[model samples]
Target chain A: MERLPAFELKRPTSLAQAIEWLAATPEARAIAGGTDLVPNLRDGIGAPPVLVDLSRVPGFDAYEIRTAGARIGAGVTLARLASDAGVAAALPAVSAAAASIAGPGHRSVATVGGNLCVDTRCVYYNQSEWWRKSNGYCLKHLGDTCHVAPTGTRCHAAYQGDLAPALIACGASVELAGPRGTRTIALEDLYRDDGLAHLALEPGELVVAVAVPAQPRGAMSAYRKARARGAIDFPLAGVAVRLAVDDGRIAAIDVALTGTNSRPFRLAGTAAWVGRAVDDGLLAELGKAVQKQVSPMRTTVTQSNWRRQVASVEAQRLVRDLAKVAS
Target chain B: MAKRVLSFVVNGRLREEAVGDSTLLLDLLREQLGLTGTKRGCDGGECGACTVIVDGRPQLSCLTLAARCDGAHVETVEALAAGGRMSALQAAFHEKLGTQCGFCTPGMIMAAEALLRGNPAPDEATIREALGGNLCRCTGYVKIIEAVQAAAAAGGGR
Candidate 1:
């Protein structure tokens, strides 16, 4: 294991205390679950001088089901989210996606907020600093041109998170707290369309919680993932679909795709294509439309063309399976 | 660098230690507490060799911060035996030839323990899914699955 460089760690017991510390120390970073931060630090990805450990902060780990939806604290581990009976029954797609993340160990330590705010990843950019420097530092870090798409001026790092796509499909919202105070926003607005500036979160802002709407009755959801390996591998392409049916007709549909772009791409037009009743042909057309919507660059574990193809196939399969249940 | 004082129970013993901020539970268990039963295969959480029971649930020690485990109860594979009597699952693994090279043994045992604690008798698919995170380069998981089945059949009462 690579040794982590020297840094100070502070454990705050309250949100106000944590905010005060962050406000005082400009270089300090808040760490709820270190599943993402520690690995990056050891890899020389990013090293802040001080780490504000938020695990001990009171009330930060509580998850509640309200009249509107479920409020998941930032410190709630992925394992808890996946295994919780309430979360599973209420939001099965989110739970299914959580269950399919890296592995049990990672799921036990990785938090929902961390996964949602995870750094945009690419085969070229997720490497050690030395490795990227040796390769002349692609557009994600220092250099000008995007190695993944040499002709394009933008970076093509994909948001390979399993939960974010599912959460977005469920119409979730998030709460953010920082030195400037707290604010709530739609989860869709948190991510930018560009890979270079993937998230719109400002410096010193910490994601506090995510609120997911209650699962409507007769709503069926599923997440399909394709990866090189069955266990402990990131998705080459993944699809999350949530459909609400009433009297054998589709009431609402949300389709979100991941591992194909910097941010989770919502197939709005494609979702609209399968409005009321979906047949095999309609599902196929929707898949084709989703394939056209996703512009995956050659930065994933699989080839870019293969990722796009798999995305189309998986999206079609997920929607078809969901429609079958609805029928 | 600042050090944090952590107090916790490990293997039926209460202990206190001062550790660095970045010290992972894997490092603390092996380097500081001298419990090497938890192996470190992939420090990146891909490999579950460092699995340990934290607050009654199996967690990857490699990814968990030692500080995060303060005030919690940790059970390692070392505590599985009672008065040198091996656990039924451990004996079943030995009888079934479930382990080879022994790198993934501790983690596999802990995972099995957690599985049995929650589900005393699991089907083939359930056992496979529970042990999916743990990688075994040798013995091909056939015997491991069989051993778990045998233990469950034997009532897994212990």
Candidate 2:
């Protein structure tokens, strides 16, 4: 049976103490839910000397939905968010994204922050310790060579997080606490293009909470993903769309995608097409833009080309479906 | 690693023990406490074989640290029967031929037990959603779903 390596666990009473513990131990990693980190630890992927348990941290469990928007705590469980009617009514995309993660058991313990900070995964990198050792590892871990690209210097592991794209599409921002202080950044800016150093957080910085600003009136959003199975599988490709139509024309639209590249990004071409009519030609053009922008590599077991095409199609379908529902 | 005094209730019995920081709840249940009913299929969160009810929620015991469940009420498969008689869900599984090899039965039952407690009259779709994390090699899930439905029909879900 696989086992976790030895490490000291510290349960801090406050966010400040958690930050202190992290700063004190450079190898320490904050654990909100062990849903993701624990498995990686068993695979011998990362060996942090200390695990700061954030469950005891006060003020990190709040889940509020207001007219302005929502303030979701880092410690809010995915199950709770998925089951909440208010979250479903207000931010259906976020709720659906939460509901679509792993399964019921995983959702019970998995947290909002953990899903947002889920590690970039690859077929080569997510193997067992024995398998990784036999393969001599890869550029993402102890090894020097990149098996995916062979000659590439950087790790091409894909960031397959489900929550980020939905949150980013809804114009969310993250509140971060660190040894330095507290600050907020647009959720899209929280990530970088590098899979190895994907999160733009500094050492000892922790994602304290996520703040989602209110959407425009009469807007609707939803998220969808394609995977190998009906459940318990990571997304091969996922898309989230927020659309507000005024007089049967696009008044506002935001689209974001995951499982394509090293970072979940807002589609950069949406702003120019805001006022265009939602038609078959416009949807075809949107699909082409998606296919052109997304760069999926050999990260998942699914074919990269298939994933890219699926992303484009899913994006177009979501836009058309949401527009139909609104009209 | 620092050892902390842990206290929790298991199957309506309270126990206290010193646990290392890294001691998983699965190990504590199977090794230290001698409750081997919770099978460790993947030893990771991928498989639902090591599932148990922690604080009325079905959670992957292998993914949970024993220290994290300090004051929680935990229920395992051993608590299902009373007076050596199989509970309604267990009997439904036994009579409905839900167990082909029986390795994944305990976890499946525990997950169903949690679901029944929350939603006594779950439909077929709800049953599938609740057991989504559990993988069955045999019976093709038809009998398992039938077993859960039968148990709910017998008033055991309450």
Best by DockQ: 2
Interface RMSD of each: 1.7, 1.1
Best by TM-score: 2
Score every model by TM-score.
0.93, 0.99
Candidate 1 on A52-119: residue-level lDDT in tens? 88887786778987656899998888888988987777788888999888766567667888888887
DockQ of 1: 0.57
Q: Model 2: runs farther than 4 Å from truth?
A: none
Clash totals for all candidate models = 0, 0
> Per-residue lDDT for B92 in model 2?
93
Tell me the lDDT of model 2 at A237: 92
Cα lDDT, model 2, residue A36? 89
